[model samples]
Target: MEDMSRLDNACHRPLRSAAALGLVAVLTAGCTGTDADTTTAAVGRAAVETSPLPTVPPAQPASQLTRAEVETAVSRLDGVVRDAMRRTGVPGVAVGVVHDDKVLYLKGFGVRTAGTKDRIGVDTVFQLASVSKPLASTVVAAAVGEKTVAWDDPVIKHSAGFTLKDPWVTRHVTLADLFSHRSGLPDHAGDLLEDLGYDRSYILDHLRYQPLAPFRAHYAYTNFGLTEAAVAVARAAGTSWEKLSAEKLYRPLGMDSTSSSFADYDKAADKASLHVKTGNTWRAEHVRDADAQSPAGGASSTVRDMTKWLRLQLGNGTFEGRKLIDADALEQTHLPHIVSEPPHAPAGRAGFYGLGWNVSYDDQGRLKLGHSGAFALGAATNVTLLPSEKLGIVVLTNGEPIGVPEAIATTFLDTAQTGGPTVDWLTFLGPIIKQAAEGERSPVDYSKPPASPAPAKATSVYTGTYANDYFGPMTVSAKGGELTMQLGPKKQRFLLRHYDGDTFSYRTTGENAVGLSGVTFTVGSGGRADKVRVESLDTTGLGTFRRNG
Candidate 1:
């Protein structure tokens, strides 16, 4: 969802095309709940130069199209999923398909919870928000094929309180540099401390106080910097990233209703529920738990356990006849390590990320790969693979992600690669997912304040508490005439309001919410204040706080 090809907006502001339309638009957001554009501290900054991705040659072995052209693009995908659910009223959708290797397609559409007669089943259970990053990179490529952890190791050699505001990029960051968001760690770093509730060991122990952008040469899409590299490759595989993703890849590929565990997608029994729209309908509003970034945006499955993991990722690691993950460690989670959307001109189309996969390559060279789990508080899942035509598709949806499952996997892989659907792709991607979700918001409207506003002081000159070694304590108080604030470790609150001299505002609420913001303060010497700031927890300026005594 956030590849905007570098025009800059989703997945932290680069939308020349929104990573060619997959899952994005969540936080800074796009994949893993649409992410980055803003952590892992000490702030070196200025990095995003980008480069690689020119390679092409070798896509010829002859399997691009057949089996009656993939059963005539699966008989026009139930009329393109009933005309994209009669045009974006997305109550529910589930789809799965795999080719050459089998499982042709499973389906489901609408009504998991809209007005309700309950339906939606290709075995229901939805929440794969941020498409749980390539299903937690196939459970860290089956713990690097049981050698126990090695995609370039180093997440402080297995999370000894992992750091990053630098210290040599915290002993050289790895697990493929935060699963290819490249450890420059900004753009969704520690995601607004998990939208203020905070956990995942207090957002990976405060991404060493947010800031960093020049290590493996910056890109951004971070979901707790890939959940601190999948909780340090599940602490070097001893276990518990939901039991190493049910013992190395969903119980050896039976995928048993998948699950990196948000309490097993809140006790499944055919799940769905996420919804959001509001006025024209879709209701079930936000319940996104995401088990502290459960390996980056909590996992959940079904499209019949994601087409048995798309037949074990086009069977490179083999699924049904045995092997279970280690086709040279899942071919290094499909190559292309970084540059996720850079080439804005000359040679044009570029984009990639691999090892948690978004990657690209097409114009006949083939490769492709993708990711797009979303949840601006609902869910919008997606997947597309080509692997030189073993072909693939997944599209789950509950509600709130406007581009309805990336226009049904781009009109079912452009009608299985060119027989139809070149456009009207959900009316050409619903205004590029409503202009990359209004370019990740926060342009500062604060509902419109500043017209002779200024009179605040003596709410005990802004009450007490404050601290903040990365959003730790906050307090404020006030009561009757009203002020509030509180904060993380479940203090929550946040009423504020005022908006002028000592500045104030609030309205924000969850999933990396970017709405009202600003809090300011700064007073000092007996006026009783000494630093406050907060503007949506200051993206790397580190959001002030101070006081304490």
Candidate 2:
């Protein structure tokens, strides 16, 4: 309800060929319960890269269909992609749909490179982007399986040197709080890894030297904390996060093509190209390998490998015969641990956070376990399953805007569950949004205790382009007693009104800037804003932007 326009979908795609596939397995349409037995589905054809799929005879009365019907379904999906791409500026997208145990459809639309005509294939390896979050969750679960750590372990316990600006809060911060984004940090607007590409040690060094918010007060997604958590997991297990991921996840599930870095895919013969949105179009970009924070958003893979991951999640933390992790750990990871504001709540009653995933209840009150991730040029990738519906969906795309991935992924799930009656994706989402709309809450009246505005002062101490390895360069300008910030193309202005000691907010914006508002002016012995720390609304990735100009 709070200006949904800011959260609009940002990209689009095209369509490809279709093929006939063979039936591999059969499943009955019924709500799955604990008593329900797991069923196996078959491997269709070699692998259809394009859609307008050749239909195989239905294995169940519910799925029985003529080739034409299957083609029609695939064709409809093609329109969905074409329209989505055109509307959202998505350069390339690869989609995989699974019904029951079978991957009923897989297709790529557009091209690996926008103008090169390198047609995307089902096996195209797009950076899973933030899709790495769920995978990270899996790694944590594996650590639990190996008895490497506990969910409730305080994060400070794992890394003795880790601390927040507030000493007491640092000791209380838990691993669950970090991964779940309940660490009270705001989403650092720019890419932490992208900007802070200084070195692998930069994150730790920054944490040791920087100040952080209280451990748990609000929900702000922090990739930095998560990356640290990943490092902690690695250190605890005496292995790198990537190796642990491969051993505990990829190897067990036979996702040989999947990896925690782009280098891994580069060594392989087949992988999709990376692209970025430019002036309403997707342009080719060099694939990046994340040496630092590999667990945050560095995993890359094809639809084929991802499907195996889906199967593992559907099987409740197991694949084939291996109990990769305790089934209870899966439940624990999915259990909502914190309450948050409406629509974006943590995990229970409404929105909530699981250990490393976002757990939401469907209209039917059944649990839908999933998380969404976004990185430069890619976004909103997710794998979601309704254990009750026995359905799962994986949506991956090449361009990053907003909501595009969620729209497609959620649409697929809606279609799969409804058995495809052809509902407009946007129209279908309307009711869900309406249901989620809390109408605006009344504005807070702070008259009882009038807030004291920060003293107006200019510290010409540092004002220049500050560059970090992950976030690139941030330009700061001080003029007319106002400070302005420029990151890439986006710009924001702030008025340094006082709060507590050194914090301030936008001149006019109120609580809307809570997590984002507090801009702290670091003082030197002379009492000047020598090193200013720019705090945003929520500390997801970027907690405090330090002044180095």
Which numbered prediction scores highest in lDDT against the true structure? 1
lDDT per residue as tens, model 1, 1-549:
323323223455312122334222111122211121124333323232233222333443456677776778788998898888887688889898888788888989878887878899898888876778778888888888888877777778788878877786787677877877778777766667777888888778888877777777667777777778887888777667888888888887777888877887888777988887866777887788878888766888889888888888888888878888888777777777767666556755556677777755555555667776666666777787776678788888887667777777766776666667655667756666656643355667878987888787877888889898887888898989888889888788989988787888887776556668788898987797777888777877887888898
TM-score of each: 0.37, 0.65
Q: Pick the candidate with the highest TM-score.
A: 2
RMSD of 2: 13.5
Local accuracy of candidate 2 as per-residue lDDT tens digits, 342-415: 33234312345556555555434456665544443333355665655445667677654344555565555544
Q: Looking at candidate 2, what is the lDDT of residue 347? A: 37
Q: Specify the poorest-scoring 10-residue window by lDDT in model 2.
A: 16-25
Error of 1 at 484 (Å): 24
